[model samples]
Target: MSFRLTTRGLTIAAIFLTVVVVGIGVALAATSTPQFCGTCKSHVPYIDEYKKSAHRDVNCEQCHSKPGPFFFLTAKLEALQQPIAQITGDYEKPILGYVLNQSCRRCHNNDLLFHPVSKNGIRVQHRHLIEAGFLCMRCHSTQAHGDAVPPGSRTYPSMDQCLICHNNQFKDPQGQVATSRCDLCHTKPNYGAVPLTHKQNDWATRHGAVGILSTCSACHVKKGACSDCHKGILMPHPAAWISEHGVIVGKRGGNKACDQCHDTKEYCKTCHQVKMPHPAGFVDSHPAVTAQKGSDTCFNCHVVANCQACHDLHAAGDPRAHKLLGGANSSLQSTPTPISSPIAGGG
Candidate 1:
């Protein structure tokens, strides 16, 4: 038979239960601290950066854990693997973590959303973003960690991030469009502030080489902003532009305009397969040159009328034209191989 519980036994049991509860509470509190997180060598760099960040005064859990007891407990339970992973050296490189919008709103508050907040000349309308269901971490991901991680891992907001939603095409629930006007977001934006890349002497000529046209498009939002300076030539020209550029060049009255972006002297000669402008006395030597290159190459710059102008004289039985026609025919007969059209080949 089971023995009856005595007063002494009951008192001792109650004290033991209380002690266990208090011990668990203490352990949970201790582990939630940034100090406890920093104990893992992998977290030391993040902790160091967090200490220097604007949110240094805020506890790690205040942002990392969502508000309410259930989420707090859940975050704590999820954190249990950190120590195990650290011991086994099995943690992921560039450790990833997500901060909930609820966690941010706990301190930031809904009041901040009603009005735009200015930071570093940027006017951010939180209400529009929050209503649109954007996460606080979408822009402020690096606020606590700073640049502790690699560039790809750092989620600090940039013009590109803003352009994702502020591209004028994106509309709110109320049908109000998100315009990409710099004035809407930038308070007294120094539009004249030349980028560091633009400050270089050769930037005017070499800007296309950087391959960051999206960065350029962020500010140059006009429809033909690039084409304006490019003289209607599409910036970062299309694949077909290589084959079709000859037609464009011909319409523009020679490759003189191409000198704006290209070193036409060398660049043109590479594809032209001959002197681009045709050196002095080219008219005299053109018969041999045309026969060697082909009539198609001539069509790149000259129409059939150009050849007809000289050939018509031969029809009239001019002595000089007869001599020139004989030379042209002889050269044409000698070159049996046919050359393809430079216009078609984009030569």
Candidate 2:
């Protein structure tokens, strides 16, 4: 059936279409509210946190959605799954969400970029940070959500987070290094105030285990601060230090420095098997000492060639030397006796 459109029929159809479009727009605006977002069980705690945040006056869609209209419409369409997931009880446990940098810049604008702001006790210059490609959410993730999330997932800015980039190694495109100095970021930093971690009884020895070593470097800026306590050794010993440490101690003349951190009397003696560097008269007394403890103890520091080199000086006429050396030529013999056996004053 072919029907021609009359003026009355066309006018009615246009009004009906306009009303439907306006109604859809009204529904979209209504559902974008925090109150509507809170209707979902997963978003209740987050909405409560948002209401108490500094951004309490800001709408949910302002930070949660991107800046432009196209992104805002896409975000709304993506949120269609929230009702379905809520009903089915299959949503993610912590319901992760992200705010784009563009959304943050929309409200913060270029004014924040060039100006330095004093917040709490921090002096923040957003110009360098934003230009360096850091996302606003990197340090301010909890600006809206607060601590509504779980422990490990909490995104509040911390000294640890600041140290990640503010460490002296990170450089800008212009080759200026990021300053790790506390005064650079902290407005009124009390350098004399000891951190609570330093108050622990065992902190002197155990602080290295608590956090990254670079975090300590942030405040203890002096080059000698670590070496002074570490006695010139690396704060955490290098991987091959065990095998090469004796040479290092030899060059330093003694283990007097090692005694600062280690209980060398008990600890070093366990490995050395004798008083290290020997007692004052060890050269003359070692024969008797070796008789008691065995030559295996001497081998910890000395080899068989060392004994041969010294014993060869004994004279054939000296009976005491002859008895100790088992004859002057005995030291020259190619087949050497075990230093532990009775052949060389051991017994």
Candidate 3:
């Protein structure tokens, strides 16, 4: 018995849809909460410190009084305030030395923090943060207190903090304060900012030289003035380095800039002394002669020293008389081994 009634079908569908909508609404209501206080995101310091704050009288509504919630709401209010300010020209200028006075006045303002010394008043007049119109939150508080952080609520400069702003470099060995964050000068302090000059020096063609761009900058005291910044051995070409390199018994550079990174003799000997490419039988036949090949690391299998032997550290270009791994003492030469097949074992 099929009775086709169009109005009844439409009514039934609407009722089912209404039930589904109400069910979804109830589920959403159960899970959500109303943000009445707006304190969920940034409330800090256990509510007690805030109550003790000098601005404790200032309501959350006066500053945070705008409609809606969160940063987006604040931003919209700020945009609207800007236009109103333009029309009215009313900028909310903070009080001068405001934060210090407010925080100090919270407990001791007139005579209590200091002995009310008139001479101290002369010294206190030099307060830069006060002149900067910074609020207490700007340089000192839980949210804003790294040494590098700009002045805020969580920040309180120590005694060394004064010297950090001074022209002279202050070192507090006690580790109480690290004033490295303060700019010595406007010049950038990062090591990576310096350019690498050594790469241009012909070594790039041979062994594929590479170095960190900032390594040189770390030693540089000031930007661009290499001589003024680094003195003595720190200089690119120290007189001491030349004196040491010239007299050393072993061949240097061989067009290899080993000295750039390595500061000592042991670095070269460790590898070269072990696996020098001399004839395989030479090690067993003449251990003393093969082992005694100083800086044998450069000597390749040809029985003669390679370019590393005679290679000039000063000027890397080829000269007519230049030979690889300069002439070794053949005066104590080893006898050559007879050619033997791999199948014919040597005793």
What are the root-mean-square deviations of the candidates from the true structure over C-alphas?
Answer: 16.5, 17.1, 22.4
**Of the candidates shown, which would achieve the greatest TM-score relative to the real structure?**
2
Off by over 4 Å in 1: 1-10, 191-347
Instruction: Compute the lDDT of residue 281 as modeled in candidate 2.
Output: 91
Kindly list the per-residue Cα lDDT of model 3 for residues 59-157, writing each as its tens digit. Answer: 333232233345434534454444455456565532111233453334434454334222311223233434445453433443211222223324543
What's the TM-score of each model vs. the native? 0.57, 0.60, 0.22
Per-model CA lDDT versus the true structure: 0.73, 0.72, 0.38
Arrange candidates by TM-score, highest first: which order?
Answer: 2, 1, 3
Better of 1 and 2 by TM-score: 2
Number of the candidate with higher TM-score, 2 or 3? 2
Residue 347 alpha-carbon offset, candidate 3, angstroms: 43
lDDT of 2 by residue, 158-200 (tens): 6666675677887778788877877887887574446667888
Tell how far residue 282 is off in model 3, in angstroms: 43
C-alpha lDDT of residue 204 in model 3: 40
Top candidate by lDDT: 1
